[model samples]
Target: MNNPTRTIISRRSRPAKEPLSKDIIVKTALELLKSEGSSGLSMRKIAKALDTGPSSLYVYVTNHQELSAFVLDAGMESVVLSNEEGVSWEIRLYETLHSYLTVLMEFPGVAGLALNTIPIGPHSLALTEYILERLHEAGIHSTSAAWGLDLLMLYASSVAFEQASRAENGTTLQAISASYRSLNDKQYPMIASLQSELITSDGEERFRWGLEAILQGILQRQSKFGI
Candidate 1:
């Protein structure tokens, strides 16, 4: 009799016969982004990873820009919006934004890609819808709420890009602090006086502080205009 266990093992170890689809290309591209940064990711590298040629990758993705967009959207697939009810919009917004940040930051170069790409993918649209819905529920006027989405996304993406770029450049907060401390006090007395406050905050602390400030400004505008 044939050994069923050996057959199962062989099947499990078999390589895929058809793996050149768009999904497979995007998945492999994301892995390339992780191993090598944005500058390092190329069609040639992805093709090599898949045991194919660079020309073959163009059949799935037109070019590097399109591939980058796909990678960014794939990274966003991990952000699961919470369903816990009875929470205030402020809390919901905070949690959602944090979750979104968490997802982007997990992929080193993907965050930087968000700066240029228009978010039209399925997951990106879902995130935009959820953010706008929360802002509307929080008493923001239609005009303000719509604009707030733009500002919120720009802020989050820019922050993530900055963090990622600094990491790639081997820069640290301590080095920034030292640079600030070395500034000519006479030329920048105000910055010199507040040096400690400017450079003392860690990444998470600084991010939370700025996020709270932006949210407070939005709430204040609503109250001021009675929207």
Candidate 2:
């Protein structure tokens, strides 16, 4: 053999293998998002995690935002929407909301991605379909129900993101919960009055309460409009 023609092999000299499927690429990207948190994930990082070049990821996902959408949808899949509650959209919505929140809680940083991306992926569309079905069951009109579900979904995801941001920024729910009891009575009467009960809520009960308020508001609208 005549010593290596060149000290290094250029990328153009390599042969292309089978491309990675979008599913595998998306899955690996999501795992990387979970490991490094949304702020820390990047195409290069994802490619490195998948043992491929950054350009390979683009062959599947367009970019980080697209990848983020996929991650949110993946997280949404963990949400269980049971129709066992029958036509009680309120109950079904309630349970579904809690379950969705639970999934976000399990993947701390993932919620923030949902907040920013807003689930435009196939999986996210499935979630939108689920929510619309609930609104329809609750007697909401097509027009109102469409936008109403959108707002509700955005709110839920945003709240989860806020919680995650706070946690990552050095303010955990536990610490915030503890601080609630020490509120200044003179400055904030309501918070001070219900501070203990309020802070004691570990996102679950608070989310349920918020969901109830939304369902009740929806029901009120239906009653008022005679829908």
Candidate 3:
């Protein structure tokens, strides 16, 4: 029998992998986060997805925490900082926050990251500056504006995390309604009485109400304390 012939292939025939950079790494991390939620953000998982060793990722990102900060800011790239002429500061603020909430809802994993990560990236800084500017226009300055920024971001992040968690775990409003229904009126009079209002409104109404309340409270406090 004749020996089988072998075909030799040149290594150059294969396409070159894209050069790794901080931007590429962050983009890949964001993609993983979107597809697999928070679990997909690990260095090993990202490296595996990029067809490289986990150690290679360290060349750009120092650690998982830093990588998380990058991913969170990258995800926020879509948040619109609208500056339409004739738009009131309050309207612009609400629009910007709504855009942020929408982005978080779209990429639920990033919502969790936003809550945990102290974002120092350019995009994050831009967001902070924009919010501060809006607060200044609203006559909230100094300590009040600074603290109000924290409160606003925190509220949005917390709401997104909670809604995402519930959606992921199949915890529907119906489930909450049933739970509320089972509560005894005598034992929890206030909760039982307000159960309908508690679970009734769509998320939008509640989110807007929360934002309005926060803005009002901030203004009231600023005026009263002169801070």
Q: Per-residue lDDT tens digits of candidate 2, residues 116-190?
A: 685687767877888888787778875678767866877787777777667667787577766775677788898
Q: Where is model 2 more than 4 Å wrong at Cα?
A: 1-19, 85-87, 162-174, 177-184, 225-227
Predicted candidate 1 versus true structure: per-residue lDDT over 96-162, tens digit per residue: 8778877777656888778888776788889999988888787877667777788888888888878
How does candidate 2 fare on TM-score? 0.78
Model number with the top lDDT: 3
User: Cα RMSD for candidate 3?
Assistant: 1.7
TM-score of 1: 0.83
Clashing pairs in 3: none
Residue 185's lDDT within candidate 2 is: 78
Residue-level lDDT tens digits of model 3 in 54-93: 9999999899999999899999999999899999999999
Candidate 3 weakest lDDT stretch, 10 residues: 1-10
lDDT of all predictions, in order shown?
0.81, 0.75, 0.91
Backbone clashes for every candidate come to 0, 0, 0
Best by TM-score: 3
**Candidate 1 Cα errors over 4 Å, as ranges:** 1-18, 219-227
